[model samples]
Target: MEFKPDLAASNPSIDFTNELAQLLLFTGEVGVAIQQFSAYRGNLNNNFSFPSDIEEISQQPALDLMFLSDVISKVSGINRLIRGCIEINNYKELINYLNKTIELYKAYSRPNEQLKEALKGDPYKTFSNTYLKGFVDLDFAISILEAIISKCEQNNVGAKTA
Candidate 1:
């Protein structure tokens, strides 16, 4: 399916840089939760935070959160597919899920110039880390899957064929 970026869903009316930074911050949360829950999880936190530089991220920094909304959505959807495979013991589906996940991740992890080319019409003209920003987004995306898994495990609702 062709990717469609959704700015409203991805960015919730916050500062763009800190918004990305916030996503990173929650990444740590997901890691910790996975250790504890080992089942379903939720959006670890609101947004991904930035690398802890002494200076705060600029409010007017170049990147557009809108551009990344679609990527995050794609990552999130893949996580769901993978989890569904695990729940049903569908080995073939699991293999396909992993393959697609890797392929999509590679495309999403491309460099800024490539992102610009693929995305087209980047008003910011800013650079993006191959996976840094998207890593959190992808992981955050996966957290929703984690939460669904948790529900099946704990509630036993569709656990057999989640």
Candidate 2:
């Protein structure tokens, strides 16, 4: 989509700062959390059974290698999307990026049946952030972010509204 700087000027209610901030923070947290998940595995396979001794997994040599590693990786591309959206004011692209992120996250996280079972009720609980606990709401957040980007487009900011 082409950039529309005029829309940003027309619509001044865009909350890019907060959106970008949250995106950056969550992406970082998710990345770190994923790293910590490494400790839950053994260089080969991760023990996913319930009631299993977590200490055992953290003690082995190869397993101990990443004893405190995270399972999620940092999403730099999301940051790039945030920057792109704010810079070019490409609200459409921003939405596309956020949508892509949601897809990627689901695709990567859906396979672990053990993790899925563990997350039974709370689907969006990333690492330890439990305020919204079970109510992840990132799917909603992406929509909101898109709407904000759209508003930015309407306001006619210095950049394009994509």
Candidate 3:
């Protein structure tokens, strides 16, 4: 997958740079956790004896927590970065970051919804709380991001000509 550009390279603020680094690092952790979880699940599917309770699969809960925490950190960091961009009147960078984030959110939204639906199939009603919270937070984050983007676009007249 293509990654975001080096945003900090052009940014002069030390705090923004530091926060961006932390966000990127946490994002990588989330990606790795998801990759490992997918691999583990794929392996389980190939095995002769599959665990009846999918949640009982080794490392699933831990990975879920990691994913949830990473999501929270990354989302908050993105919000902070947005504010930083606005503080510096860097509309170009702000729009770039917002578009990238929105693109990612759109790409992942369907799969996330599917997973949520799957969790609802559990008759025991014992779902992964971490997973649910992550979903809720992600939805909220996207809503906020979209609203910001709408406002930006609405006020962005003639920015392209500048």
**All candidates: TM-score:** 0.33, 0.40, 0.43
lDDT of each: 0.40, 0.44, 0.48
Candidate 1 lDDT, tens digit per residue, 1-162?
A: 555454435433211233235444554533432222212223233234333331232232224344344444544454455444444534344334444544454554445455556666342321133223433444454444344344434543332432
Give candidate 1's error at residue 9 in angstroms: 33
Per residue, candidate 3 scores C-alpha lDDT tens digits across 1-162 of 345665545754323444345445545545544543444546465555333444643334454544445354656656665656655655555656666766655544444555446544321121234434332334445665655555556666214312
User: How many clashing residue pairs are found in candidate 1?
Assistant: 16
Clashes of 3: 0
Candidate numbers sorted by TM-score from highest down: 3, 2, 1
Task: Give the Cα-based TM-score of candidate 2 against the true structure.
Answer: 0.40
Q: Per-residue lDDT for 1-162 in model 2, tens only?
A: 455454335544355666656655555544443333354433434454422343432323233222112222224555455555555545566556555655544543345555446544223233123322232334444554555556655766445522
Which residue runs does candidate 2 get wrong by more than 4 Å?
Answer: 1-13, 34-74, 112-162
Superposed on all Cα atoms, the candidates' RMSDs to the truth, in angstroms, are: 15.8, 10.2, 9.6
